[model samples]
Target chain A: MKPKIAIVSASGCRACETTMLDIHYGVSALNRWAEIQFWPFVLGSSMADLERIDHLDVCFFSGAIATGSDRAMAEMLRKKCDRLVAVGACAAYGGMPGLKNLKKPATAEAADRGDLPEELALPEQENRVRALDGVDGIDRVDAVVPGCPAPVNLVWAAVSALVCGGEADARITYAAARLPEEMVRPILSGLGPPPGAVFAGEKAVCATCSRKKEEKRFKAVKRPYQAYESTGRCLLEQGLICQGIATREGCGGLCTGVGVPCRGCYGKPPATFDPGAKMVSAISSTFETEKPAEIQKIADDFVDMTGCFYRYTLPAQCMLMKG
Target chain B: MTDYEPKIIAFLCNWCSYVAADAAGVSRFQQAANVRVIRVFCSGMVDPSYVLKAFSSGADAVLVAGCHPGDCHYISGNMKALRRSFLLANLLKEMGVDEGRFRLEWIAASESPRYAEVINEMSESVRQLGPMH
Candidate 1:
């Protein structure tokens, strides 16, 4: 009596192969508690086979948002699945396709290359791509997995938990930082913050990093090369631009710990709130310089590195490129 | 420190890095033994975290070698790698980690000798930066 789970993948994402491979190996390690079914790639034996599939206990949607006939197919899966989960950055956060949220010409050189198939061809304009959350009338999704092709472990763990009925205790649950009741409550009421609401030192990390000789802090603002000293002080305090202050702290600060800046992969509303936007606003006022474009480019390139993870998903939230 | 030799993991793209590394070996270029090469389909597959993973897993340094920006075998894989490297370096600096632990360079298949030279250069730089913990 194994629990049944189905995965629905689209054409452009091309993650069906990788996800299938991961699931095959991942389930081998699991206690064989669930029966797996994949659509399109695996069970597309015939049109009758598609109709034969009824509402599934669990369903995963992977790939970028598609339109025309593809949209109808996606909607059908959404209706037939009991528990719907968005896997992979494209499905979960709109990946490269979501970049249309911001009005910008595509800058990714890969977008023009012929490696990816023609099915992924975006609309000629920036208004085309949208996150699943942005699709009108869609309510909350059960869960989301982020990453270019959402890491194999993420899919395995989430599905395993659902099958075991301990989904609430899943380690990858969404845990956004709690904004002040004063700021959030009013915003919920449709009232924006006061004109001079300066966001400074709401948390200890921000306070400690911005400390100006008021407390015992590390001297000398270190750059990428010099910050490697074995001191545990925040790099931002030492005059280096660290995005960890605004970035979510799940990745074990891998970027900061390894002599790089936080690219904001785990930050904000992957659909609306851009991690790059928050980072620049936080530092722009502090690190004032004449050459603003140079600093902006450095920040832009950082977010672009995550590719579809950050850029394509929350194009509007991007600090430099907007999209 | 007895002439600290940096242990570097070089992720060579199949077309460029692999060919260049092999050429270096064939040309008998005198390079540091510290660098170990791993072949990947393209530089785009080299996630930024992979660089951090290498360093944390006892690698003194990690180098992501690819074809020049426009020369990726899979079209824009190198460009993606470049974009990723740009972010990775900044992320490392933000984390209070030493920046020299990661290096991103481009080398052509015809530049096997240059690949060896780059490896030796990175080893020297990491040696000066001290061991990453």
Candidate 2:
């Protein structure tokens, strides 16, 4: 019998759906052993149809828990599916919507009331956003495939592995797929140490980043808007608040590889409890001043400290209040 | 309200602030009884997690006391601590933690009175702010 799979999209922008499509020919390969029982985006399956499904071999859930309905669906999937995979950064760690938590609650409320006109009043349901893990009883999620959109190949590898009765090693295989070639090549060639790191490499993003790290000393922090020549040196060393040192290295330095500073989309590295706080610690240690006033002045250069630090994982951060 | 005592966690560097705290006790200098001191080798060794954990674990405020700038036993450890404290203060504010809740002070081993003064001030300020959520 073919394995039955369900694809659930919650409060995301369908980026995960796009990632599914990006698999291209891999879909056909997956179709050989798995039957997509319900995929609302493509299969036109309704909630009633989802409820009718008695069992699902695997359920790939995408997006953050942003409403009462989203939480209900997540719970439903957990009950109905044997194996549930959180298939994106939103589902895993709250993603971009988490950034809204950085704003003061009063400020967010005022913006909601003041910005929208009477006819365009936002729905009450929109205010109930929460991270996937924030919802009670969500800890039972079996595995997580974390990324902004979740690299299509990694998802494909994970899904195929699950459908082939290799459920035990699916997560490990997905993590290996996310590892950088440079890190994996050593192990493959038997030259470097064994691979024991989860999802990303054991070290921070800087360990896999190609940038040259010279001794860094910065008098002032530079915003991305302020122009600076990219001399192929480390962006953090050049005064741009690149969070590579605090970020997990899964995206293979996709942003930093192109001169754009990493905003830590992949969340905190292993052993890090809070990504925002860790970034603050790393950036602070680089400031050139020991004088309190001068240090404050340099810190003032950061326009939005919380936004820069918790852009991707605010909902799951230690200091932020749970929704 | 007068009976409400704030619980403060003080992370003191062994070389400077911790020694100063001990000296203050030896001199019979009275400080706030609310503070619980944890000694580390350097102020830079205090990770932001430690401060956040203190707050989460019911600490009304956290004080990181270190060597004066240019006086770090490790040459630049206190300097690094100063920078971290600056960022942590702003982060705490952004998280809606009141300004007086997290503090960083430069206290040399010789300035035992300064340690007593800082603790007293922190205790007073946190008492005014009440307990953290």
Candidate 3:
């Protein structure tokens, strides 16, 4: 019997869902192994259909809880699904839009206003964007696949584990004759990463990079434009603020592999506090800035520390300053 | 504002600021009652998360105090603290955390009066700001 799978989005840009369309094995292959019950696109399913679904085996819920509608849909999906896989950075850690938390949320006075008609009222967005698990009704997410759009191989691994067991993978491999060994992870057998675990490797991105590393003696931070010496050495050693030191490993070090610094879209690394605070602590230890003027200079170079460090996680990390 | 008390979490280094706080207590100097101190081995050891967590928990304001430059028991620990303070300050500002809510000061072990003064000053400033939102 095929497992019933549903793929849904809360308030995402649809990139993660769009990326799902190219999972290498393709949608046709997915249909052969499991029943995709309620994907959000090209299907004739409506909210009524979603509400009517009895018990889905897995629901790949992408994006963050931004509005009242998004929150309700998240709760509904969680209740309807046996396992909720938080796919992409927004669902896992509250992605780019989470940065809005830095600004003051809407005023209580505005919420009290009753000028608009019932139909004219806005969708009622929440003060701060939240990840799936952070929603009040949802206590936890079974598995977390973190990335900008969520890397394909990791998603495939997670999908394979949840939908079918080893027997199916072997049969599919035999049938297709193109199952790569590295792609089918032995550990991600069923449900992939134990409950509430991240889908990617446990190591930080620095461990995966092929660049030469030396003892860090950071004198100053250089903006990406100011990075002069591009000799394939460690980006951090060159005075550029590469976040690979604190970002989770996966994506095959794609950003750093081509001289671009990691933006840490993969969310917080395992066994750590918030990555932004950790980065700050690490910077303090390595930085040799002495005088007040020098320290301030380094601070100025950061320009936007919140965006740089907490770009993808401010919603989870933001202290509630509003009602 | 006069009736309200601001909860200030002060991370005082065990070697310098904590010792100074003790001396201030023994000297019977008038000090603000609002500051609650957590003695750390070194100010540098106060991870940025600790301060951020303190703010989110209940602290209206947080103060991290260590030995003055060249006076740390652990050599360059104070220097690291100084560097971290700037980084933390910048981050707090970016997060829209009230400017006066986070502070860093250096008090030598001999400066008991300075310890009491710093505490009282921080308490008064926070009182004016009212309770943390």
Index of the highest-lDDT prediction:
3
Question: What tens-digit string does per-residue lDDT give for candidate 1 at A288-311?
Answer: 232334444644443333342355
Worst 10 residues of 2 chain B by lDDT: B49-58
Q: What digit string (tens of lDDT, one per residue) describes model 2 on residues A75-149?
A: 888888877877777877777776655554443476667864444343324453556766786666665666778
Best-matching candidate per DockQ: 2
Give each model's whole-structure lDDT: 0.55, 0.77, 0.79
Assess candidate 3 and give its TM-score to the true structure.
0.91
| Stretches of model 3 off by over 4 angstroms after superposition | A104-120, A167-192, A318-323
Query: Which stretches of candidate 2 lie above 4 Å from their native place?
Result: A24-26, A103-128, A165-198, A225-227
Alpha-carbon interface RMSD for all candidates, in angstroms? 11.9, 1.4, 2.0
Task: Give the TM-score comparing model 2 with the true structure, all chains together.
Answer: 0.87
Per-residue lDDT of candidate 3, residues A1-323 (tens digit):
89999988878797788767777668887787789999867476788888888999898988888888889888998898889999998988888867766654454235567444554347777877788888889987998888898877777766766676665554353223222333344433532445665767667888788788887878888766888655778888888888898888776678887878888887667767778778888876677667878887776677787788877777764443222
Residue pairs in clash, model 3: none
How do all models score by TM-score?
0.45, 0.87, 0.91
Q: State the interface C-alpha RMSD of candidate 1.
A: 11.9
Query: Which consecutive 10 residues in model 3 chain B have the weakest lDDT in total?
Result: B88-97
Candidate numbers sorted by TM-score from highest down: 3, 2, 1
All candidates: DockQ: 0.03, 0.72, 0.59
